[model samples]
Target: MVDADQTFVIVGGGLAGAKAAETLRAEGFNGRVILIGDEREHPYERPPLSKGYLLGKEERDSVFVHEAAWYAQHDVELHRGQTVTAIDRGARTVRLGDGTLIAYDKLLLATGAEPRRLDIPGTDLAGVHHLRRLAHSERLRHELKQLGRDNGHLVIAGAGWIGLEVASAARGYGAEVTIVEADPTPLHRVLGPELGQLFADLHTDHGVRFHFGARLTEIVGQDGMVLAVRTDDGEEHPAHAVLIAIGAAPRTALAENSGLALVDRADGGGVAVDESLRTSDPDIYAAGDIAAVHHPLFHTRLRVEHWANALNGGPAAARAMLGQRVSYDRVPYFFTDQYDLGMEYSGWAPPGSYDQVVVRGDTGKREFIAFWLKEGRVLAGMNVNVWDVTEPIQNLIRARTAVDTEALADPSVPLESLT
Candidate 1:
């Protein structure tokens, strides 16, 4: 139960913030809760915007997380187009962009991630875009709409989830998309070789071009608009536009300015938070991609950009915000639907962490699953078309169940048979 006067202020109204607000109300908190989002429109689902929303299958209104009426009825103070300038934890006040201060007892930072940009010359050209926000999606939708040709060239930088999804959307939008990845295979880190190859084939079957081992030297534009991309191999392509979907780093400026401790990395600097999702400051908590949480499953601190993590982790932060002690130990599940292939993956397979991998399905039909096991225990698994097996395998991984190497290689034996 929440005290009537206690005000909970959540900064950044994305999936994490919106879900936190709704989850708080569902958890029986009737206190004054204010949700501040910089977006002009109400909170919307981002996953579809990269897939169905861009393909004209889903409408903007159909993808909204919640309507204004729903939020009003639940007693949430929804502030759109509002920016949080600074956080004064000592005073328990947050400064807005319009020079107003809002006081709160508990504060949640869902500051999300920003798109990784390319520093090439013609990157700022007209046709170069990054799929980060809803506005960006709308712009891309309009651009794809304008192209009268069925196979317009759209060059992408990375083959990560966003990059591939955008490629799929663009392909569905009647544009011929080409992915330029520095890595050998798509999703090399997460999906490993076998599963990533399946994804590559899936995209290739849809008439997508893969430029593996391609390094972009310059974004060559013509007449004030993107025209071509020059690679390190001294080759220029007839490109209509460039979509830089490399990846994203956590939005940690707020945490850094507040003198909150951060999970330092040699590569990416992410927010450092304790087990309760509380930041260095006890009164404040962090969630979503921004929060670098210590995971019990991986035995390490991690920052996940997965939709499931945002939907689940934000509510866990809300619970901790309400002074309820509960450990958030949900094993992360990630999924992506590209063309006819559906992919689902769970658990952590750090870079080169798995020595030997086991495959249980055939890659010929592209309808199989593979698992990454370390020392006879399952660490991670990826399903290409057979996603129904993720549940039983996820449980086996969760339970830390060990299996015989031959049994793992056997497809006839159900994954649950080992139990």
Candidate 2:
């Protein structure tokens, strides 16, 4: 239980930080609750940046985690647009960018992840965009609208979720788009070749050109404005705008500077935390994208960058901080939307860990429930264009039950029956 006089400080203003602040209040931590963020805006969700928000279907107000007045009403101090520069573990305080020190009885670091930047020439040119924050997406959205009706070509580097989603949006805006990826198949590292191929085919059907197994050597530009992207094979693809969406890296500088244990960079660098979300210092906890937590089910330490983990991990960390019996054991989950296809996936299995995939429904028709299994036990499940079955799919993975392959691939056999 938290003492009445203790102050709880939450660093980072992203989803995880905001959720942790809410959890602390909900759990009756009445002491000073300060939520600090480097950005001017309050906590907001990021999924819509590449989808509805970019397309102007969603308003700016909808992205915020809470209204401006909510914080004042809840007695939570809102410190925005200020950076937390250092952590003094012995003093139990953090120094802000402006050199103001704030004491804390407990600290939660949810610094989140930042987009990995491209180091190629012409990257600093105008019209070259990277979508991680609302500002980036807003700029890209405006440029896409200005380049209306196939008037300009948009060249995108990397074929990950952000790249593919941006491709879908660009196509919707009637812009000619081309994607450059070093991998032969996009998303192959995460979804495996077969399923990854499905996404490649999906984009191909919608008239999006792909340069597979090709590396981007330079961004060709004129007068500080992007004109095209040049690949290693000497192929120059024309473009008026460019987006770099390779991936993201965790913001672990605060953890590293404070001498906190961090996971190896090769294995996804982030602050290391146990199943309880506690760092080397028990009073400090790391959650969300900044936490490399041990997953009990997979028997491995994994860092997840999805919204689900941030949403659930916050409360779990708060409860654990309060000395409650808790464990952050929720299965890893994520989803993506492209064109007319939507998918929801549960469970986390590294590539080559699963022996086989048993798929139900029809892949050709773009509707299916694919289950990845190892030693006849379900490890992960994904439902594509299939509704009302996510719970059952997740249940199948959580139970870790040995399943009949035939029944798993049969449309008539309910997934719940397997568990």
Candidate 3:
């Protein structure tokens, strides 16, 4: 057993940091482990924040992954409501939001990303919001609670995941929401053109208006309250509130300032990491949204920002820290709930990768599984309403199984047959 005095410091107590602490303890790491986070709340699952939690179907406590007693039992030190201000790589010390320094034997930076803000005029207005933290979701819930009597409109600035989820939440509150995307579709980068169009239709079915091919000119407001939004399409939309969910960039100032090597990605920007989730510095490891992980299947370094990523990557990183020599090799899984049904998508269905998509049910029927075929094998699959196939499809994709599309698309064929 490692010395109890040996300290393992984990920065950022989100899913990644919290999971790392749990794994270290489970691995018989009796050493002192500390988890630091900017948020005061115990580490909670974030996926429900937009769906069930924001929609008033779930309470705040339900979002929490573990309670206070769990951490107490595990002997994990969770320092919430604090920030990590700086890092001294030369001495292996981390500085907190306050002027305090802590030495560490191993440092794991699960420093998450912050939602990018729109730099238009009047963006500082009061009703303008972004969904990234629990506090932000709480504010949204408050605003939503007032929807029936007071709320009227919600302008979503980005068509990304958070933006779409916020839009869904607003719709759930009976607010007339409009999603203004600078891109053509909400999930243009993540999903290809056709699937993006399908999601656009999904939102439209729920009375959510989409302003595609739009560039936000300014956030028109008065007296610190947002009143309207002006777009480059020469249209002004009235709104009671606005959600800025454009995108998120990895928070890497502490790492870059500490002379860590950052990898530049071509698809825009992302942080770089090696196979073991280690940064340029051997002693420091990066996980969660902040690190660009080397994908074993894709043969690329991809930055993933899903709840599944945090849930899985954090443990894989912990194993690596324990000399288990494990790499984070797994297909990504993410889900979104529209008004009536849930859409769960797995893996990166890159453009031109899928030669054909076999639909298991009618696309217009509101429940179906579509398998992405690349050279006759299932590369990825997107499902709406039917969730039972998600696991089997993921398994097939990982095993690189060649699917019989003729049988898969048949109405009588069970999803288990593909496995």
Per-model lDDT? 0.84, 0.90, 0.82
Q: Using lDDT, rank the candidates from best to worst.
A: 2, 1, 3
TM-score for each model: 0.96, 0.98, 0.94
The count of backbone overlaps in candidate 3 is 1
Residue 232 deviation, candidate 1, in Å?
Answer: 2.3
**Per-residue alpha-carbon lDDT of candidate 2 for residues 81-189, written as tens digits (9 for 90 to 100):** 9999999999999999999999999899999999998888999999999998988889999999877655789998999899999999888888888999998888878
Task: Assess candidate 2 and give its TM-score to the true structure.
Answer: 0.98
Could you give candidate 1's per-residue lDDT for residues 67-183 as a string of tens digits? 779888999999999989898889999999999999999999998988988877788889888988888998888877655264568889999998898888777778878889988
Ranking of all predicted structures according to TM-score, beginning with the best and ending with the worst = 2, 1, 3
Q: Pick the candidate with the highest lDDT.
A: 2
Query: Where in model 1 is the C-alpha error above 4 Å?
Result: 148-150
Name the runs in model 2 displaced over 4 angstroms.
none
In model 1, how many backbone clashes occur? 0
Model 3: per-residue lDDT, tens digit, 228-262?
Answer: 99999899999878888878888888888888877
Candidate whose TM-score is highest: 2
- Lowest summed lDDT over 10 consecutive residues: which window, candidate 2? 143-152
